[model samples]
Target: MRIRAAILAALLWVGPAAAQSDPAEAARHAAQLLEQAAEALNGAEGARDRVRALTEIIRAYEAGLAATRDGMRKAAIREAQLTAELRAREKEVSRLLGALQTIETTSPPLLMLHPSGPLGAARAGMMLADVTPALNARAQDLAKDLEDVRTLRQLQQAAADSLAEGLAGVQKARTELSKAIADRTDLPRRFTEDPIRTAILVSSTETLEAFASGLSEIAAGEIAATNADVSALKGQIELPAQGVVLRRAGEADAAGIRREGMILGTRPRAIVTSPTAATIRYRGPLLDLGNVVILEPQPDLLFVFSGLQEVYGEPGQVIPAGSPVGLMPGASPEIGAILSTSGEGTGTDRSETLYIEVREGGRPVNPEKWFRTDKDG
Candidate 1:
C-alpha cells in the first residue's frame, strides 16, 4: 500500500505496529493525525458553536503539523542510516549475489558431486543446507532495507502536500475564530470594565508592576463572586501555549536587561489558551508588551501572557480552562519553508515568542515553578 493509504488504514484500525517505535510507524501515526485534523476542519463549518469549533480545529492542526514534522525528521534519519548500512555492506552484498548466481546457473547433480567422493559430498550437502538459509536471509534483509528507504522518501515527499493543507486549514480556522470571538456574547462577567479608569491607570503606570497593581481600580461595578480555586493544581498546570522555553526567569537578554518572566519560542500564530479556569483581569496592549492577557485563576495569583498579535476575551470576564486567549504574532510559513526545514529537527521555525509571568500577591515569581516545563514543544 502507498503511504497515504496506509495512514488512512492506521487511523481506522489500531494495528499492532501502531504501538511500535519504528520510524515508519511513527510517520504513519503522524499522517493519521493530519488526516483527522483535515476532517475536523471540514466538520467545523457547520458547527453551531463556531468559536469552540474553530479553536479545536486550530489546535488539531497544530498537533498534526508538529507530529508530521517529527515523523519527517525520524524518517530522514532512518533513511540515512539504512543508506549508510547498505553502502557499508556493498562488498558482502556483491559476494552473496555472485554465490547465488553461481548456484542458480550450475546443474544440481554436478553441484552435488565432489572430487573427494561420497563422504565428502554428504558433508558438503550439510554445509550447504546451513549456508544457503543464511545467504537467503541476508538477501531478504537487504531487500527490505532498500524498500524501506523508498517508502521513507515517498512519505517525506507526500508530507509536503499534507503540511501545506494543514497550514492553510489552521489559518482559515484562526480567522474564523477571531470573527466568532468578536461576535460572541453571553460570556460570564465577573465585573464591568471602567475604560476611563483603565486609560488613566495606563497613562500613570511606568512599568508592568505598577500597571498590574492598579488592575482593580479599573473595575466599575460590583464584582461577581466565584469559588474556583486552583491552588491544588500548582506546579501541575500546563503551559498556556505550545512552545519551548527560550529564556528562563531572571535570564538576561542580549541587551543585558533581565526579566522576571520567561520567554517561550513558538511557531507563528500558535494558539494561546487559558491554563485553567480563570477571570480575565486585563487583556490588551500594555506597557510595550504588545497584546496581553492577564488571568487570575486564584485569589492573589495572576498569570500574565504577552506578545500576541490578536487578543481575545474582555476584561472582567470569567473563562473556562483551555479557552483560547490569543494567537502569537507572524504569518504561518509557506509550504516550501516547512518542507525545507522538516528534517532539520530544530526550533528555527518557531519565529515568535510569548512572555509568561506569574505573580503572587502582586510580586513577580518564577513561572517555571507554576507551570509544567518538562516538554520541549
Candidate 2:
C-alpha cells in the first residue's frame, strides 16, 4: 500500500490555546487520513490485508501526533498574547473611553465660557470629529482580536475530541491485525498423509530427523529423477514464501544454538510454493518439527521445508515451481511457537518461522548464495 503523512497519530488532550494556525484546514486534513485508516481496517482480511491496515493506522497516529503538538504550541502563544500584548491594548482602550465621557458631559455654554473662548472650543470640536473615528476603529480592531482568541480556544477542544477517537481506532486496528495472523487456517497441503504408518513411526522416533528419515524410506528404493538443472537455476529462483529472512545458515538461536539452515519469517499459512520443480523425496511429521517436506529439485540437490503444519505431496511426486507444497501454522507458541523463538526479534510478530536448507550431496548449503534476494531486500 502507498503511504502518506498523518497528523493525528497521538493523544489530543493537551493544554489548549485551542488549535494552531489555520486549525480548520489542518483538522480537515487529519480527518481525511483517519477516514482512510478506518476504511482499510474494515476491508482487511488475511495477513497481507491486516498489514496494509496497520500501515494506515500508524500513519494516521503520526498525523495526530503532529496536530496535538502544534495545538499545544498555539495555545501557549495565544495565552501569552492575551496576557501581555492584548492586556496593554485593553488599557489603552479604557483610557480612550474616559476621554470620550468627559467630552460628552461638557455643555456648549460651558465650552463658550472657556479660557480660550468659543473659537478654541470650536477647533476642539472639529479635532474631536477626526479623532472619534480613529478611536472607534481601534476598539473594533481589539474586538476582532478577542473574537479570534475565542475561536482558537474552541478549535483546540474540537481537535482534542477528534484525536481521542483516532487514537482508539489505531489501537483497535493493531488488535485486529494480531488476531488475523493468529487465526489463519485456510491453507493447502503439499504432501499426502498415511496415518496408519505415520502414527506408529511418529510415536517411535526419538528425534525430528529420525521421524523424517522413516518417511524418507519410501524413496530409498525409487529412482529419483528430474529434468531441471540445479546448477543453472542458482540465484535465479523465487523465494519459497513471502517474508523477511532473519537468520542464515549457521546462525544461532536465542540459546546461541546454531544450525545449518536459513530461517525466515512468513505470514500465517503462507503458501510454501516450490522455488523450482522437484520430485518429493520425503514428506511427513518430524519429532519436534511440525511437518517436513524434502524435495529434490535436481539430482543431489535437495530443498528442505520444515516447520509446516501440513504437507501436500507424496514420495516421488513431482511438483513444479511456484506450486503449493505445504502450509505453516498460526502463531500459537505451543506447536508453532518454536518458529517465533527461533530468532531474536522474529517471534510472534512475524507470524511463522520457516527453516530452509539447500543441501548438495548431503552437505549443508546456504540459501542466500542461491536466491536473488534473501531477506527484507
Candidate 3:
C-alpha cells in the first residue's frame, strides 16, 4: 500500500512549463514525460531504482514550477502591451471624430441666398459648389480612420485573451507541482518535526524488547532451580512404615475405615476420610492437620493409614526421614510390626512405606528426585 501511494504521488507531479507557455508543444512534452516516469517506476526492483524514479518525478515538478513563473511573467508583459494598444486605438478614434466635426462645422449654407443683385447670387452659388466635394471627401477619410481604430481594438482584445489563457495554465501547473513535492517528502518531514510521536515509537519498541528479555530470564531461572532440586532428592534414603496400605481407596471406604479412638493431639473422635490416603497421621486434640500427615512419596503410590487412634503432627510441619506420625486402632506404632495390604499383587500383604510423591509445577514427576524410594526395604 505504501509503495502504491508513493508511486501515485510521483505520477501526479506536474510536467514541464513549456506546454503552458507554448500550449501545443508543451503538451506533447508533458505526455512523454508522464509515460516515461510510469514505465521506469513500474519496472524498477530495488530501492535505488525507486529513488531514481522519484527523482525524475521531482524534476518534472520543478520544471513545471519554473514554467509557470515564466508564463505568468510573459502574460503580464503582453497584457500591458495590449492595454497600451487599446488606449492608442481609443485616441485615434477620438481624433477622427474631431476631424469629422470640424469638417461639418466649417461647411457653407445648404440653401442659396437671394442675391441683392444678379452677380452676387451667381458668385454665392459657385462658392457653395466648390466646398461641397472637399467636405464629402474629408468625411469619407474620417470614417475609414474610425473603422481602422475599431479593428485595432479587436486585435488587441484577442491578444489579451490569449495571454490570459497562458497565465491560467501556468498557475494551475504551479499549484500541482507544489502539492506533489509536499506529498513526496511528507513522511520524512513528519518524523523529523514531531518529537512526541517519534519518542513514543522508540519507547514502545524498547519496552517490548525488555519484556521479552525478562520472560526469557524467568524461564531460564525456573529450569535451573527445578533441576537442582531433583538432583538433591535423588541422593536421599527413605524408610518403610508399619501401617495399612490402601490401593485406590475411595471416599466411602475411607469413612468406614475410620473408627473412634484417642489420637495424640485430639480426644477420642472419628477420623476424616481421605481417599488415596498417601499419609499416616494420629487424629488427636489438635484442630487443623491434627495427626494428619501427608507423606507424598512417588508417582501413583498411595498409603491410607486409617483408624488413627493417635496423631503427632500439624500442618506444614516437616517430619524427619523416618518418624511415626500416628498409631492405628488395631495396629501398634512399634518396631517389628507388620502392615496389611489389599492390592492385586504378590502375597497380598507386605511391608508398606508412606509414599511421598512430590510434584513440581503440577506434573507427577519422579518422587525419587525428592525422596529415597530405594531405601524402603
Question: Against the true structure, whose lDDT is highest?
Answer: 1
In order, what lDDT does every prediction score?
A: 0.82, 0.60, 0.34
Query: What's the true lDDT of residue 301 in model 1?
Result: 91
- TM-score: model 2 vs. ground truth: 0.44
lDDT tens readout by residue for model 3, 1-377? 33344334332422232324532233333334434434443444344433333343333332332233333333334445555665766766576567557646854453434456657767866875786686567657656654544544443344334334433432343333333333332111000113343234334444322322222222212211111122334535332232222321121244565311111111112122222212221123222222223333322222223234444333222233333344323321111111111221242222222222233333334433433333111
lDDT of 2 at 71: 46
Decreasing lDDT order of the candidates: 1, 2, 3
Q: Kindly list the per-residue Cα lDDT of model 1 for residues 179-288, writing each as its tens digit.
A: 88888897898999999999999889999999999888999977777778898887899888878898999999999999999999998889999999999999988889
TM-score for every candidate vs. truth?
0.85, 0.44, 0.20
Candidate 2, residue 70: how far the Cα is off, in Å: 26
Alpha-carbon RMSD, each predicted model: 5.0, 13.4, 43.1
> Could you say which candidate leads in TM-score?
1
How many pairs of residues in model 2 come into backbone collision? 22
